[model samples]
Target: MSHIRLLVPLLITAGILIGGNGLQGTFISLRASQEGFSTSLIGLVGAGYNVGFAIGCIYVSRMLRAIGHIRTFSAMAAIAAASSLAMLLVIEPTFWFFMRLLAGLCFACLFATVESWLNASVTNANRARTLSLYRLVDLGSVTAAQYLIPGVGIGGFQLFAIISMALTLSLVPISLADRSSPAAPEAIRFNVRKLWNISPLATVGCIVVGLTNASFRSLGPIYGQEIGLSVTEIASFMSAGIIGGVVLQYPLGLYSDKLDRRVIILVATLGATLAALYLAIFAGGDEWRNLAGIFVFGAFAMPLYSLCSAHANDHAGDGEHALVSAGMLFFWSIGAIIGPLFASVMLDLFGPGALFTYTAVVMVAFMGYTGLRMSARPGVPTAARHGRFRSLLRTSAFFNKLAGDGKNGDQR
Candidate 1:
């Protein structure tokens, strides 16, 4: 009860923040397509956003170090709100690209601020609960926000105004709340060589999941529009993956906790490969099958990062989980930065269906890598496991930083 009272403002802040971000992501893809932006150009815009987001993840840590959380959050939130409205001011692809880049930078900072606040407040005992509640806010808001697309009307300025309003009003909670904020987090470190030594499989796995997930997120709506779905249905199409991530995260997490996570990773990659194949070739014209395929693909793909984190922690030296988590996100961001362009070119050459082809190919490569790694090294002993498999939001570096902070234990 005390915890709820203390964190309610921050939780509300996070929910509203993610809601606006969710709306903007789908809104841009839908609107860009409607404006006749080339599929490649739209993908570039999305890639530009990821580029800004990646920079923000590293930059926000330093910015917070210099300025503290409240000022950073307030300023970033304001910038994000203004950036949302800026999209409405100009309709060109280049302009939208710049707007999304700015939004990404702002969201990256907001997430870091919110997460650092949560981490500083929760004890090791309550870390899981705090993180779970945070995840609930994240998944719920992002999923529901997608439904705003049809009602707001993709062609009009209404959705942009609404997103900006949400961002602006969200600031009120933080400003009015009387609770104390968390201390600033120390600078997070990332050493690629050390990360690879800890768990090469995790390093490879993060990149693959990033590539597959980023491509779908940035370009999935255009795929839906190409296949003749209305804007509302496209919203559902995007939401289905989030639903899959929510429903499947824990059960698979429980299973992975008890087994060689490499085995679990292999199983997940194979599952994603099959699902992507189904999406690419067999799910034609049937919304149910396409949605089901995406849901299953998400179910399999979303948890691998968590699984990889758990796997890496099992092999990491004591007190290195934070460092490794930061490194893993860096690897993931690299994949994300490159993924949209790669997928967009595929879409350009092969059509909307090729999006799944991109995923399928990557999952196959991932499966091969995991298979080789499993053959080369024995599994981390379950008894010796040093970390739990917690479902992480892939949106920002904040969660990755949090994942490293608490005592490691089996989550399920």
Candidate 2:
């Protein structure tokens, strides 16, 4: 019961952070259109955020080590809050690109601080449950943010103000808390070859998930607009995917543990591919139908990351969990950096439907690759594996730290 008390502040902090984080992608994509930016150009603006986020992960470890958690969190929160408002001050895609980049940068550091604080706060006994609650808080807040968008009306400054407000509110909880400082976060080492050797499929899966997920989140609003959906409908469409993820992630994960993990990966990628194709071909003019299809997309697409991550960790030695998890994220960032730009180009050259078309193609390619890998190697006999599935949250740098001192395990 007392542990719950400790977590409440951090959970509230997480919710507020995710709320702002959720709204930023959709708000910026929608607003860019209002400012008359081209589809490809808007995509670049969105892509800039991922690039900045990667930089934050890559570079901010040293800064966090120097400055400490509370100060870093507060600093990033202020910068993020200011960045939200700064969007209201300008209309250029290039300016907005930098602003989104700034938001991403702040969030990366902010996520690192939140995650480190959470890891530090927990004793080994309650770490698993606490982390579980944190993941639920994350998904719920992000899902809520989608619905919250309609209330603010995306065409004007109101939405930006709301994003700024959420980020501001996030600052209060952590700043006022009486928690002790955590030890400095570990310096992450990114070795690409080591990751590929651990599990080629996992490394590749992270990158492809990055490509598909980021494109959908960053450019999804534009796709919604391109189709016949209203702002309210667009919110619903985005939320549907998140809802699907929350519902299906655990059930499917439990079932996956019973079989070769690659089998589950194959099935998930196939479902994702089909969902993307459905959205591309059949989802026009009908919001509910679109919602249903997107729900399936989320169910399959979102869990693929966790599945792949779990698969990789199953084969890794205990000490290497952190390195493997962090490296997987490193690849994910590479894919995310490139995903929006690529998806956006498809939108420009083909149509808005090209958004999903691109995702579907990628899924198909991944599916074939996974099939090849499965044939070549035997599944780790279920008894030999030590790690379990952990849902990966893009909100934090805690991927390596999530499982708690390497006892419970790491990310999705």
Candidate 3:
């Protein structure tokens, strides 16, 4: 009970920070459109964030080790808040891009700091409950934050101020709390070759999700605006996707545990590809059709990461779970950095519809790749499979530990 009490401040801080960041992401896309930024330029701006995120994932642990979680969170939160405000002040494309880059770095570190603390504080007995609560906070905060764009009217300094305030306020609970800080997280080192050897399918799956999901989130608002949806509708569109993601996690997880995970991944990829194709070709400007299409897309697409993680861990030997998680994330980051830039170019050349057209193409490619891999390799037998399915948030490597990665040989 006392340990859980210590986690309250961290969860509160995560909710505030994640909500602020989520709103800012969607708003940035909408605002960039209002400013008449080209699709290509906006894509570059979006990619900038991932680049900084990738860098932070690798280096922030060093800072954490030296200064510890509280100080690291404090410094990063201050910088993130400043960067949020800076974006409001400077309307130039170049300036906004740099600010987003800085924001990404700060957010990666911030999430890492909080997740490490949570990881350290929980016992294996209660880890699943704690992780579930944390995930609930993460999903609820992000989903609710989408509505704020329409609520605040996304136009002036006011919305930006709100975002900055939320980020800055995130610092207060942790700083004021009387709890001790956790041990600093170890620095992440990538051995891409080893990860590939463990499970090529999971490695590729992470990259594929990074490409398709990141593109959709970064540019989906623009897609809504281009298709004539109002701000309220756009909010619903985004939230529907997130909610749909939650809907399928447990069901798919149960099946993945019984059957081969590859089969699940293949089916999910096919579903996502079909949904994207439907959105690209038939959904058109209709609101309900777009909403339904995106909902199905999210349902099938979102769980692929978790399935992949489970599949990889099945093959990973003892002591390899953390390495697998970190490596997969690093690969995903690489895909994220490249995904937006390519998708943006497609959106520019083709149309708003090209957004999903881009995703559909990518999904189709992955589906084919999954087929080839399935042909080559046999899955771990059901009894031999190590872990159960857990829904994941791509916040940080330490977050994976909260799922209790190797103990009892359960899947993280």
Candidate 4:
């Protein structure tokens, strides 16, 4: 019953978040197509959201510390709602960029607060189940939100207004939820150069994961549209990949924990390479095949970073998790910035197939490096040997980051 109560607020929050983000998979591409925006420009707009999101992550912790989580979350949602609604009035790409920036900032704070709250509420005993449930709600909400796109014409700004309203309403539950005082805000002190020195492989892994994931997020819709998938089908294709990631992450993480983390990463990269190759070579103009390939790619590629993060944590003490997380996010942002540019260039040079080719090559390189590392350190276990996958799930800072203390927050 208590879990049921907890889930009520979580579901509401997920609704708001999914409403805001899920449509992007189709909305951005559709909007660009309607406006006749250049492919490169569209890519820039998509990348801009990531840049804004990264910035928000970097700064939102301090904002919450100063004002408390409830106020911070409410303000963020309000801002995001306003910005989203504002999109209806302003159709200019440059104007939309600023709006996306606002949305990104607000979304970051909202997610961070909610995730922290979820983390604080969870105990070690039930963390994995709780986190898994949280992720399920998140994935389900987003997938469902995708279905909303077909009802509202992509050109109508009314859809965005509705999304904004959802975000506004999401603030109510968190604002009124009964909870204890929030934790003291942790300071983020990132030393990227120092991180690189400490774990070069982990650092590189962060970059690769960021690049691959961001490209998938920003450009996948465009690719879908290019291949002649309808908006609804495109949504399903993108959602399927995310669903696969949510399902596969823990199992893969558990397996990585038992062996050298690098080997798991290598295997994942290889799998991603194969999936990408299949998509590039054989899935041409076939929607179902492309979707399947994407799902497989996501299963292998999306979780590799979490595994790398766990591996990095294994080498650090408890105090260093925040630092590592921050560093990883930062590197991920850098990669996110580069990923779109490279993907765009490839799209221009070789068409939609270039997306898969570019990603596959990167994975191949990472796999090669991991193999070399294994050769040098043949038998060392990079992570603990335990089937504590369920237990470890509860320990995730990612969930905490999402449900920090906000009404509608979930982070990855």
In terms of lDDT, the best-performing candidate is 3
Candidate 2 segments whose C-alpha is farther than 4 A from its true place: 403-412
- Can you list the residue pairs that collide in candidate 1? none
Q: Can you give the TM-score per candidate against the true fold?
A: 0.95, 0.95, 0.97, 0.89
Model 4 gets an lDDT of: 0.70
- RMSD (Cα, Å) for all candidates, in order, is 2.0, 1.8, 1.5, 4.1
Candidate 3 on 1-412: residue-level lDDT in tens? Answer: 6767778988999999888888888999899888889988888889888888888888878999999988899999999989989988789899988999999899999998998888777887677778888988888999999998888897788888998899889989988888888777666677888999999999999999999998988899988888889999999999888888888888998999999899999889899999999999999889999999999999999998888988998999877887887877777888888998999999999999999999999998998998999899988998887677777788888877787643532454
Residue 259 displacement in candidate 1 (angstroms):
1.3
The TM-score obtained by model 1 is: 0.95
Model 1 C-alpha lDDT per residue in residues 1-412, reported as the tens digit of each score: 6876788888898999988888888888888888889999989999888878878877888889889888998899899889888878888888888888888888888887888787777776666677778888888899999998987789888888999999998888888999676677778766778888898888888888779898889999998988888888889989998788677778888888898888888888888899889999998767888889889988888888888877887888876776776677778877887899899989989998899998999999888888899899999788878756777776565675455445441221
| Strongest candidate by TM-score | 3
Candidate 2 lDDT trough over 10 residues, lowest sum: 403-412
Query: Residue 273 of candidate 2: its Cα lDDT?
Result: 95
Q: How much lDDT does each candidate structure score?
A: 0.83, 0.83, 0.87, 0.70
Cα lDDT tens digits, model 4, 1-412, are 4754664675567556755666754576567767877667676776777677788778877887788877887788888888877867877878877787777667767777776666556654555566566666667777777777766767767677678778888877765666654774666777777777656777888789877877887788777778888877877888888776766777777777677777778888888899989987898878899889999988888887777766665554435656766676667777877887678778767888888888999888888877776676543353332112221211123442432222222111
Each prediction's total of clashing residue pairs, residues at least 3 apart in sequence or on different chains, is: 0, 1, 1, 15
- Clash pairs for candidate 2: 403-409
By TM-score, is 2 or 3 better?
Answer: 3
